[model samples]
Target: MREFDYQRLVIGYHGCDASVRDKVIQKGDQLQASPKRYDWLGHGIYFWEHGPARALEWAKEQKKRGKLKTPAVLGAVLHLGSCFDLLDAEYTDMLAQAYPLFVDSTKAAKKTLPNNRPLDASDKDQLLRDLDCAVVNWTIEEFEKDGTAHFHSVRGVFQEGLKVFPKSGIHRRSHIQIAVRDPACILGYFQPPSKR
Candidate 1:
């Protein structure tokens, strides 16, 4: 009867095409979950936690990649129920422990674990997180097999972009992100307020 519920609510932003945003906000359409194999947080609906600016920036980048025509941001009220928060040391250690298990499973299946690769030589952050994705997905499967901790959401902190200043560890694009595995956790969707 124990649930690892965080009992916290937060505003999350999703970046997409302008049409997609209108459908979800005005027509009440469901936002599709991203299932990319190299997704940073495995397969789920991704969001920028309390970060509308970051979310719009991402949409713009997606447009450059031909993923969308016109960038847009959608706001949502999220309940971080039963979240596997990587910002905490506990979940991070658990993920490290899950690595070998993930390796073993892939080996058993006669497959190789993919590595996180950079987009280009200049891409130091290694945006393609195949290895991280596999381990996270495997860990969730372990929980499912155990039938104890079926997490409804996952939260992670990602440091990205160029340094704001020389000799500074702070990155211009550092932000906290979330992946909602359960659609029910999304209380409602709204139009993001314009920048003040």
Candidate 2:
């Protein structure tokens, strides 16, 4: 079990339209937004941890897809506030326990578990992470119901793309992600310093 300094605050960066960023800044907080059914990390405001360039890349891609007229990166200072960190063994153990419960719940409901798959044969940047998302959400739900703990956010490091070396866990596109379930964890939002 590796030790983590959960006490330390971290910065998070989000990619979105310039208009959206402006609205959030003007409002002094992020507007309430529903989580997408296909959200990669199960229903929260998503940010790329320490990956401003990745955020910008996503923004540009959104612009190219006509989803955003003016792409921008929004930065935030985050206090994790009871984080469910996947990188840690404690959380992973909780998840491991939750998986069986999740499976049983889905089976009882007569629904198949959502399975993850590649977004496309050639697309390495995105994966269909529905299954992982579902399990995490289920775990949170169970915890809330039992009054054991309330997680304000979930954090994880995902290793994407080709590995940096043979038998290495590190990847060319690895990045940390933070999903803030509670808006209060976001201390404040700012425009990327470079953008200003």
The residue-by-residue lDDT of candidate 2 on 99-145, one tens digit each, is 99899999999998887777678867567788888999999989999
Give the clashing residue pairs of candidate 1, or none.
none
Superposition TM-score, candidate 1 onto the true structure: 0.95
Per-model C-alpha lDDT, please? Answer: 0.90, 0.83
Could you estimate the TM-score for every candidate?
Answer: 0.95, 0.88
Candidate 2 accuracy as TM-score: 0.88
Name the runs in model 2 displaced over 4 angstroms: 1-6, 27-29, 124-126, 163-169
Off by over 4 Å in 1: 1-4
